[model samples]
Target: MTLLRGLVLLSLCLASGQSAGDQPAPAGSQNAPCPLLSVNDPVQRDRLLYHTCYLSQPTDLGDWRQITPAQLPAQLKWQASNGEQLAFPRSQLEYWIRLNLKNDGPTPGFWYLALDYAPVDYVSFTLHRANGSSVIETGDQRPFDARGIDYRYYLVPISLNAGEAATLYLRLSSQGALNLPLSLLTPDELVAQSNTLTLTHGLFYGALIIFALFNLLLFISSGTRYYFFNAFYMASLGLFLFAMGGFAYQHLWPGSPWLANTAVPLSMALCALAINLFGRSFLQVRRQSPLTSRLMTAQTGIACGLLVLALALPYNHAIAIITVAALALICSLFFIGVIRWRQGHSHAKWYVLSWSLMVLGTLTYALAAFGYIPDFLQQEMIMQSAIGGQVLLLNYAIVQRWRDMQKRLWLAENRAKMRLEREVAERTTQLQDAMRDLEAANQRLEALSTRDSLTGLHNRRYLDGRLTELIREAHRHLRPLALVVLDADHFKRINDHYGHAVGDLCLRHIADELKHAVHRPQDVVARFGGEEFALLLPDTDLAGAQRVTNQFLQRLASCPAGQREGLHIPLTLSAGVALLQADETQAQLFERADSALYRAKAGGRNQLVVAGNTPAPVGTATNRNRE
Candidate 1:
């Protein structure tokens, strides 16, 4: 088991391309003095001082320390070969030595001074130290450009005993200025470059906050899980980037170096979690092909393994593994997005493009970190370009998603409108059909109420309507209007002598005679009831009405019904005629006509009577000679 574990550790170290050792020097050389001075320049030669410098002041004397400086010669002379050193007793403080070089050459040339320290064992190198401090150191080492050349530096702070001795090497050469050219930088340029990284980190965090708030609002409004996942993933990615770049340690909690050291593993874990969640949301990885899902799972597992390795290894090894794993994870995400795009998910196309750009930027930075690219191309400018491109691509993808959602919503709204219109049209058509049917039913009811079924003549309701109209016309046009009321004499005796069917035939015959008597189109004849009928005439005087009524009675008396059981029966009618008064309604006109009818019946069964002009009922004896 031990051997297997060793092999696994070795494999991880090899995979990450990191050295496993933590101690800077070899074994059995624990007390050897640190060499701080070296000379490689020929243009200038001087003896430079080597000492443990203290930068603490009297602001707070409890955490302060002091140290003395020592000098060495330009060359390794016999007397100056024994190097000098100085140290301070305090443990947690930041200090640096000011190495003074005397120029031996006549012309001013470049000289190099280097300060070296062991790997950091504590959280931070504070200019002042306190017990409850929050300062921490991130294991991010990079070359700094002072003016025109690069200067390699370390920020790790350490303390030595009161009499500890260390050697310093001084090198003076014309090429030294080409390597460390702090004197060449303008003050503005120095400040700008110094805080460029810090500003970039701040902008990244600000973007993360904006994206998180935006997605949080979306989640609240739409209740979609995708927005939730995007918020979490974006926030995690921002934190991981901040931690990996060591900006979190530099400005946030500079006192806790142990916390800074843990950033690598913690960032890796968050990165893994972010990828896992993003895959599920953006790619729908679980529902994709089984092989593809397995591949995604494997990638997620690799990210998890990287975090575990970071925790188990030293700081340097952890950082190396995290960087390599981040690259691998980015590559995997890019390819997965490409695959989804090919499978007809158009949404994945934007994701693929975004990831491709990110992968290119990551590879560029990786090449720069591994010394495969030039320092100038790998510095602040390139870093900004890469990160800026990624942010722009992500913004474009978000905009594209928004546009697609809007289009879908518009289409759904249009479809609903068309569906509602169709439903309304159908309902309107049904209502129109129902209205037509109701009109037809009302006409049938009117016909049944106003027409006689036996003779097909207008019934009593028809007489009532026409009489009122005739009376109105008489008043309006100053013309005479007359109404005649008639009855079939002995209609009940006819129904008893012959069957009621024959009696109905006799009434029908009397109705035909009354219609024939009325020759003017303005006259109307109707069956008022059983054996009774009415005639209305407009523009007809009382004499004309009396003539028409007497003719109707004679015609009815002469009408013969052919043999019923070899017997013939004669039909006769009694009628009464009246002129409409100026102010008379149809009801009053009918009453006057009916009173004349009663007088006609009293004189004899077959006779005609004229209202208002008749002294007594005139018998039909006058019209009987003409028939």
Candidate 2:
């Protein structure tokens, strides 16, 4: 099928070539002198080629024979140029150009006829002089080593003696656009032109190489697929540009004309693939808009198909397919950029701008090729400049994307940190509250352990601890401290007669009486155990201690237990009081008070006795007086 198509396409080209060949010259232009080109010692810089050349195409499609220069005046019909490059559609048609030159100076004329367009398959120059005629032929179809001058374009050397007039014949044939833009240049002008073209190409290709390497480095360092895709795009695009400008043929694969003819289509196909990959990755279309992603993927398949066809098919057919695919690819990518931009992709705007310039440049060159517009700038130059701008702009876009990604990552980390801090702060507050509650519970437990359950007074444990503290304080300050120990006069009898419940009531009454008698903040009153009680007084001497003990006994005698409840149960307390002496321990003082309480019980049970035999009166119900 592919071969059949190639054959049909070749037939069409030949048909078109034949039709163009039959086009008539402008009226009365036949027999007119070939436009005369006057050359001086130095060629005029501003004399355009269109002003001096006449073009002619053979009318015989079947006549494959070459014309001789001697036969030219009668056999060929020349048409004046329209003052611009003569453009025709893609064809393998032959075009003949005639130029009449006159050297108008004493010095010989040395000129170079330059064909700036690069893809011409074959070009032949025949110089007809008065003495003889010579021909030089060279083009991309020939090896680069075969050229007389080592240059990318076809340059044919022309010379004339002073005042000599001659006619030159040029024959060109190509399978692509036959846009003949011919120029005559002296050696100096050609050098200057070469310099200008070199600088322009250097800057354009340099920017592309730089962008490719920069993105490739980014991909290597970061492992980002987007950077890799961008690098691939730039590299492929650069290759396409090089092949399009004929640099690949001139410098890269000069001996392989097959490779040279296939290079443009192959590079273009690769560029298409790269564009799809880069567009999809850059726009994040897969994640953001799946449909758009699928469209780009389909375009990628088309590019792959183009690649296969470029290798398998002939150059003209492959190039025709590549051209249509490239147009569709560029327009589709531009629309994808617009779609992604609308969907809020960050780099989409840059994508759109880059493709917009590319589309403009492409259309400009295409229009000039089809004769819709004048070729103001060389089509290659316009396209190269546009692509250069696109590369730089997209590089900026990639950098911007990197910065934006960094900013987003930083913001996410900061937000996570703030959330963690808030959690920590809340947990800290909760822990502090829990600690306070625990402390309070511990204090309650301590209180429970140290209080008398029945009497609600400090128990013997508390009395012992307080006595030790007060004794130490007294020794340190040389202040007197007092200890009193007392017991219910007949606690056992009360428990036996009225039951243990009433006995508990009586003990509570006695505790109340003791509390009333000792009204100092520094006094410690406690149930000493069983029915015994003790009082700890700080800063109280022997006399003061005796007085407090006596008063407590009297109060106990007056307020008998069960009186409020109408039960006649009498209650009294017998106590022993001891003052803290110099160098006395709490154990010794407690033993002395306990011995004094035993004496009081022995002396008839209702009296107060002090330690060291200091005795108080018995407060019996009969006498109720002190002894």
Candidate 3:
């Protein structure tokens, strides 16, 4: 590198007609004939002009000297060549590039010199005329308004009459590669080129703004975190590009030299932060792979550390750190995306593609800054183009992921609805089965409450309730109703001679006989009390009730109670009948029937008696029906 730099300086000296070991040339040497960089080509007005100029730098720290207006006229020494380009390694020493220009022509009107490279930190351009010298100084290290020309790049207005001559000198020093490309432009060329550059940068920044707004809309509409991170990354990249290109120094932070100096490195650090955040979220690293996710997190932490260092370190040091962090971010994101793609992440393809473009662009930008790449419009616009492509690819990935998520959500909702329907159907079936069991159990309970346990006849409570309902119904329908109270004759004797079981058997037999005799579906036979049973006959009369009693007696005599061992358990019964009267209360009717029962028992057993009539046969019982 040292040899190459020596050779470059040697060529610069040879082109300037000065020997390497010669004494320093005096600056005020109008008598000496030096080459004049004349802008005679109207078509190539934007081209570099051959001129008399000198380039110098301080030998060491002890040789420090202020590059002011007083010292500049005498300080300029070696002249420049028209065909030679000034290219040098990065250095801290201030370089003074002096130009002795004379427009000794017939076609010139207004001429200007423009410095192409935008990254020079401190630059001062001076136009030395015969009257006196006037200086205009501007760079990233000074206020943007301090420039002789109000433009983005370094521009100095040179007024030279058609046959007049003037000396122009420029001082430059930076922590950047010293690649000076000058254009001696006429009025037309200056206006046209300046407008072109402005329009290009305007459109570039416009596209970047559009991308940011698009991502913002996406984030708002879909509520996805990745879109937000991607938007932030685009914004940071835009700022970094703007600052690095010196537009920030000219337009954005004109009054803040410190801010202008730090903007590029700070924005670069911020870009790293955006990339890490965007990569981790876009790839879903946390959910895809824990190990890779942890790695990404570490890289993200490193990027944050770079930002902190950016605040503390100088521009040159911080920019280096930020550049390395940007590289690390690219590698980490690419690796994570590849891993996720292999592990079945569908969006990883687009993520990887986007990062690849950005990586290429970043590499190109870094190389161009180090003078490794030839400076051209394409080289200057490389990062812009690549970043635009990245924005498109990343947006597509976001849309794809959103669509996939929508599909999954729709499927989940449908499945949940179907599952709910199935559960409802199952629950309904279970309820139906339970209802059937409950109905059967309720029927058994009804029987237990109203039936006689020994004979399965309606019990006393049922007899009372049913008889009342029957009486009311019969009354409403203007029909007949009757009740017969029956008792097992010689029931006590049977119990004493045989056993209580035999007496029970006798009662059951009489109950069955009475039940069978009734025949009417609406009629009911219920056990009134011990040895007594009541038969309720709905829509029946006195004659019908009597026939039922006769039939019951025959049934009892035919089928004795039951055959016990080798003997027959015989059972005989007497009954009392009561016909309902609309005017008579239940007690009056029951009392008359009970009185008739007493008369029948008093006469003889195995006979029936009609209430308020002759005592043919009767039985003792309280009429449970109380209608």
| Per-prediction CA RMSD (Å) | 26.7, 24.5, 24.2
Candidate 2: give its CA RMSD in angstroms.
Answer: 24.5
Tens digits of per-residue lDDT, candidate 2, 44-69, equal: 42455444455555556444236655
Which has the better lDDT: candidate 2, or candidate 3? 2
- Cα lDDT of candidate 2 equals 0.74
lDDT tens per residue, model 3, 596-617: 6777777797888988643321
How does model 2 score by TM-score?
0.62
Ordered list by TM-score, greatest first:
2, 3, 1
Return the lDDT, model 3, position 491: 83
Candidate 3 TM-score to native: 0.59
Error of 1 at 346 (Å): 2.7
User: What are the models' TM-scores?
Assistant: 0.42, 0.62, 0.59
Query: What's the residue-level lDDT of 108 in candidate 1?
Result: 37
What lDDT is obtained when candidate 1 is compared to the true structure?
0.54
User: Best candidate, TM-score-wise?
Assistant: 2
- Local distance difference test, per candidate? 0.54, 0.74, 0.71
Q: Which residue pairs show backbone clashes in model 2?
A: 617-627
